[model samples]
Target chain A: MKALDSFNPLAVFVYFMASAGIAMFSMDPVILLLSMLGAVTLFVIRREGRQTGTHLFSLFLFLTLTVINPLFQHNGRTVLFVLNDNPITLEALLYGADAAAMVVSVLYWFRSFSSIITSDKLLYLFGLLSPKPALMISMALRFVPLFRMQAKRTDMAQRALGKYKEDNAIDFIRMKLSVFSIMVSWALENGIITADSMAARGYGTGRRTCFSPYKFRPQDALLLGLSLMLAGAVGAAMALGGLEFAFYPTVSKISPDFLRLAAYIAYALLSFLPATIEIGDALKWQYLRSRI
Target chain B: MKPIRNEKLRRTVRYLVPFVLAPGFVALGITVFHEKRYAFISLCIAVSAVALFATGFDKKRTGSRRLVIVSVLTALSIVGRFIPIFKPVTALTVLTGMYLGAESGFLAGSLTAVLSNFYFGQGPWTPFQMLSWGLLGFLAGILAEPLKRSRVLLFIYGIIAGALYSFIMDVWTVVWYNGDFSIKLYLAALVSAIPYTVSYVVSNVVFLWVFAKPFGEKLTRMHIKYGI
Candidate 1:
């Protein structure tokens, strides 16, 4: 199995949730920086960093979020300049940048998350919690593709029947509306049929059991344990106020103490863990290939 | 088919879960996780509320056909969201609510937000989006009669839904930025969000005006014919 695939979905889910949660909740620059680095590293490693468009979009989001915070918020003391007779202070700007970093890092983490956690994995996770929602998700996912194909066919048939000319904006909207209504009626009718078929096959009649190929091996356990421990460290730091960084009226100093240093290191290790595994896995495969 | 064992119990569960638990979670987030993590905590509350709402629609009571129909509507709404400009998600959801009942409408709206986000990319904003859209459809379901009786009222309701959607989302924006709700910041967010809100209102009105008659007829026919 591939190194990334070797980890169970549950383990991966836990790791991402913990990583993204810390990134979302914490305002500390050190933690945010580590999160950004880790997320970017994973993206680069997994996708080979070829997705320029999304990178640009992320940068744009970061810039907009960073700039927008200072305009409305005027609580800071260190005055940078005045726009419209309002002092745009350094504190608000710094807070904006920090908030932007937090948002962007979380975004990156989720992007990686979407890539790693496939629908089947999500279904598996959800099935463990609640079966009905999982079934609904599966059904919805199934219908999305089916409906797309049906919509295409419906559009083609409508055009062949001379139903819509689409010569103007009004005509275009009319065509879309006609097609959508047709799909709804068609889907509702077929959905009943689908349900009848399911009923015949004994759905919702007996105890439900979910089948998944994933096994909780030693590596999965190890990964899950490591993530939980690291996340616990960060949570403890948060509870103890070791991770606090205030930026309201004035900026507070980030004095490095033992607990703060330990929390930072723990978060750094946690964030980099996935990328480290990826790198190690790549090197190991290369060594094996060379020996062969 | 087994009927709902206790209608009163189900109703209590349906109402209490979202109302009681959502605020309880927010309280927990504020006290335990601190104000800094309020957004994250609220997100948790949103997810749980959606999940609880979904679970309340038991397959035995609603039947598998209703579930399938809800899923189909959700898929359609997700696809509608992808259409260039002027999304019909709200119009479609409102119709679903008007015909299928409030629970299904809530399911379709919330599911559309989440499942579509799978393609558009999920973020901290996702749960809030789900809740907002879900609320619109739920309210539409509650006011289905008045909305159906008069075209003018339906259009006005559509406009109100758009504004309501924007209002809830502004709540998310303020909470996310400040880590707590402040009235002044919320007002600023609402003002700055006017253009987007107008667009939301327009799209809802436009789509409803265009598709309501045709789609409403189809849904009405299906409900009568198939008893779905």
Candidate 2:
């Protein structure tokens, strides 16, 4: 539910990544579509809807993508229209829909990931791989919002000075060059300070341990087992060619059709792990609250 | 004269601090992780690492106001890169050239291309990014003195520049994707590229509108200080 309350960012990350990996080789378009839908739904359900702007724009964008993609790619058997010299096919539209679904789905996965799995969780999970790489990622992610804030403050201060007035090309050029020079210095100083502060904390040294709020209880283990089962089933389905379908000629030709359907179900279930856990946590917390 | 020189060096350091460290590590991770042909990733790492290591180059005092102005311009330029109108590299290059002169433009333009990849994925285009953005900055410096007019003049220049920007990126993509000289793919790419190509232009135009005069004024103030 919250980054602070998560067992391991790695668990969630591994699940989504595995699903994405599975989705890529999915023989049945139906399976891919379900996984895509599953990812979006998870995205919607997560983050406490704090940054609603991104969510709103994401909806509009996904809709536009769905509508417009088919118009551009007119290469399919079932012609939806014959405009002048070209034919618009149902296949192309469907294909576009698929692509749109894929893109939006991926974006949704990323959004949910950022919300539920903050840097700390991610670091705790993957930090063992390499200290330098982990620190760099954490620092960069942390810097984005900070840099944006700093840039604003700097702008305001400069604007207040009334020094931002120059005439003619040569003078204008001269003025901006100096401005850039100063900004760069500010950035470097900030960076050095951050790096120094981080280093002083003994960050990447000697048997690194992370304190997790959520303990690995029985339910967590059960969830983990279920997750593994679902993942395995999904993989088995894809390898058997269960969920691959194309719309160019007609909806035809994907292998192990029954197995593919089973795989899709497993994939969908697997994608819902975070949502399920968060909701379960929310309910448990609410129940405890209600009891109290 | 010696006092002025020391002052200038300090000012230069003040300007370069952030640009050096932030993307420097990014370039390094990218260098080691994603190994591919062209040693492009290594080049990126080298450029940013070199820049970062040089942070101690200046110890002179730089006016915070001057830093503020460049910060605004740089931020706007980064936002411009996201618009997908003109190629990010081209808009960055042109902007660098127009405001910062040849040398600075070159660095800014190239750095933008490499740095912006932090948002998007980095791949074979890293070298091309350096070249394209750097060249745009170089060209901007060349054209800076004469171009003074309304938004329309800028828009026109941006469009032309956007087209040129697309040309280079497309050429590179063809090489990266191992695309043969197929008229079909070319036609598809050319037509499809309009949004991305024009985005650079539209965004740069927007950026120019918002920050141009303010940034220009600040730079001139700094130049006056540094005797550049």
Model 2 Cα lDDT, one tens digit per residue, A1-292: 5522455454565666665544433424566577677776666666545457866776786677665545555667787778777787887666556655555565666556555555566555534332322333344445556656765676666657766565567765555555544664465455545544655776434433334454455555665677678878865554444544556567576565578668767877777666777777778898999998
Off by over 4 Å in 1: A1-6, A48-50, A162-176, B1-28, B35-37, B182-184
Reference contacts preserved by each model: 0.54, 0.00
The candidate that achieves the highest DockQ relative to the unseen native structure: 1
lDDT of 2 by residue, B1-228 (tens): 011233344345445545764465455433322211223333344344333322321122223332223333344455445644343345545655676565456545554554455555343355566666666666667778764345566556666666777776776543222112334545566777888766756765755654456556655554575433
Deviation from native of the Cα of residue A261 in model 1, angstroms:
1.4
DockQ for each of the predicted structures, in order?
0.42, 0.04
- Measured by TM-score, the strongest candidate is 1
- Kindly list the per-residue Cα lDDT of model 1 for residues A1-292, writing each as its tens digit: 2366667899998999999988888888899999999998888788833479878988998998888778878879899999998889899898888888888888899888887777778777766655666678888899989999999999999888886676878788788777877888788889889999999999988755466778888888888999999999988888787888889889988889988999999999999999989899999889999998
The sequence of per-residue lDDT tens digits that candidate 1 reaches over residues B55-161 is 67653477788888888888888888887667889998998899889988888898788788888877778888888888888888999999899989999989999
Clashes of each: 0, 39
